[model samples]
Target: MTLDLVNYEQKAHEAVKSFWSNREVAKQKQLLTGKADHGERAGVTAGKNMDGFLALVLDIIQANGLAHAEIHQNRSMLTLPGYFRPTKLWDLLVIYKGELIAAIELKSQVGSFGNNFNNRTEEAIGTAYDLWTAYREEAFGKQPRPFVGWLMMVEDAPKSRCAVRDASPHFPVFGEFEGASYLMRYDLLCQKLVKEQLYTTAALITSTRCAAETGEFSEMSSMTGFRPFVTALAGHVAAAAARLD
Candidate 1:
């Protein structure tokens, strides 16, 4: 059967527009209420900045297959057992017939790229490792392996595009990262995540602040692009649905 991608490209454009618009709205709201956070934190502390992307993912799940799957987006229903911790909360979770089908993590970075990039990298690797180890121990019971996905959106700005120097006093860093930009680093991270089997698929996208008006975004590479990400997800969902038939 042909894979149903559900016209994700247009939906992705809309999601990008919503992402920027929501951030601005949140920032303004916080400022008006005298609760503005430091730097770009005010824009993200509202926590609903990614709702559009979440909705897009939900549409893909239902359109491709698994319309009846229980997709958890609420904070309370998103936690799963972890190997190194009591529980870890995911951005989204899919369960059908009492079996886990998929878990996805969605993240974005608008500013503070230097420190936040490192934090995001560590969190992504650690989360995947913890979940996979728990899966190895049958934490989700006797069932097929679930799809794990990670998607990130970064602001396309001069800072993110500029080459950054690595401080390696003792050992030289990898050749690929010697003078890579933050955006390039993220692309490398996503590629390695999939190559290392940390996540079933990892995607990276970039958009400027003006994307709020134009809904424009760019992909760094086809391997880590949004198209491949949704295609893999849709195929997995369709296959899972077939098993139920």
Candidate 2:
């Protein structure tokens, strides 16, 4: 069956625009209140900059045939049992007929690229490991494997685009990462996440702060682009709907 992608390209453009504009608005609000955070944190402390992307994903789920699926986005309802911990909160969760359908995480990085990049990578990998191990332990009950997705948006700036060198004290680092920029590293991370079956799919996107008005964004590679991410999600949701029929 053909999958409906919900015209994600145009929607994604608008999402990007919203992301930038929201950040600016949050930063300005904090400043006006005389409680601004240092650096980019002022912009992200509101924690709603990624909501537009979340909406886009929700549209994909509904358009593909999961309109009846119970989607949880509230802070209290987004937690799932973890194998190593008590619980882990995801950005979004979908359930239907007492079965988990999907769990998604949306993240972004604006500055502090060096430290933040490593942190984001470790968090992504660890989150997937915890969730899948919990699945194996029957945390969500016996059911088909659910769709797991990770999507990241990073600021497209010279700091993120310039080549970065890693220090190898004992052994050499991977050749692919010899001089790769942070953006390239993110693309590689997303590709490896899918290649190793860690997640159903991962995507990377970049947008400038000025994109607040133009809604401009760029993808590092087709493999980790928004199109493939939404396509995989639509197919999964449609298949899940078919099974419920």
Candidate 3:
């Protein structure tokens, strides 16, 4: 059966819009009313606002016909054993009768692009290695290799769109990266993640605070577009369903 992609992009955009809107409202309501101290990080709990995006992904998975699979998103159940580490909590996980099916990680950044881009990249690469290595060690038991995916959302702003200067100090960076912006870097990152087989598919999406409410967003490349990401995921889910009761 063909996957229903009608308005999928807009739906994903709405999820992100809800996330940002909640964060802003929570911060303003607390700070402006003087109910919370400015030094206390009033909106600190807003980090989990991204759960909306997670839910949207789960919906897509279920719609693709794996609704009976043992899917997990709760913090406790999300933790899976790794070869390099004892355990790692993923954003989403799926299993069928104890057989590993798929795992996905979702991440987003609104500011401090320079300080966080490298960190995010490192974590993503490391997580994939750790999971696959663990699978190699039979951490999740004997089953076909599980599908892994990565999705990232970045705020569309001037700072993130401006090209960054690279300092190789020893060897010049790759030609394609010489004058790439953070968006381009992320696009390359997602594309390479799939190219290198680190993740089954990776998607990169961007939206601005002002345009987010209207469910407006843009894709950097077809490689990282939502359609490709969801299409790959649906295929994986369908395969896993054959093993389900």
CA lDDT scores, all candidates in order? 0.94, 0.95, 0.83
For all the candidates, what are their Cα RMSDs to the real structure? 0.7, 0.7, 2.4
- The most accurate candidate by lDDT is 2
lDDT tens per residue, model 1, 56-162: 89998998779889999999999999989999999999999998999999999998999899999999999999999999999999888899999999999999999
Q: CA lDDT of 220 in candidate 1?
A: 99
In model 2, the runs with Cα more than 4 Å from the true position are none
Worst 10 residues of 1 by lDDT: 1-10
Candidate 2 or 3, higher TM-score?
2
Q: Over the stretch 1-245, how does candidate 2's per-residue lDDT look in tens digits?
A: 98988888899999999999889999999999999999989999899999989999999999988998999999999999999998999999999999999999999999899979989999999999999999999999999999999999999999999999989999999999999999999999999999988899999999988899989999999999999999999999999999996
- Stretch of 10 with least lDDT, candidate 3: 37-46
User: Candidate 1: global Cα-lDDT?
Assistant: 0.94
Kindly list the per-residue Cα lDDT of model 3 for residues 107-211, writing each as its tens digit.
887777888899999999999999999988889887888999998988889989998999999999999999899999999999999999999999998988786
My TM-score estimates for the predictions, one after another, are 0.99, 0.99, 0.91
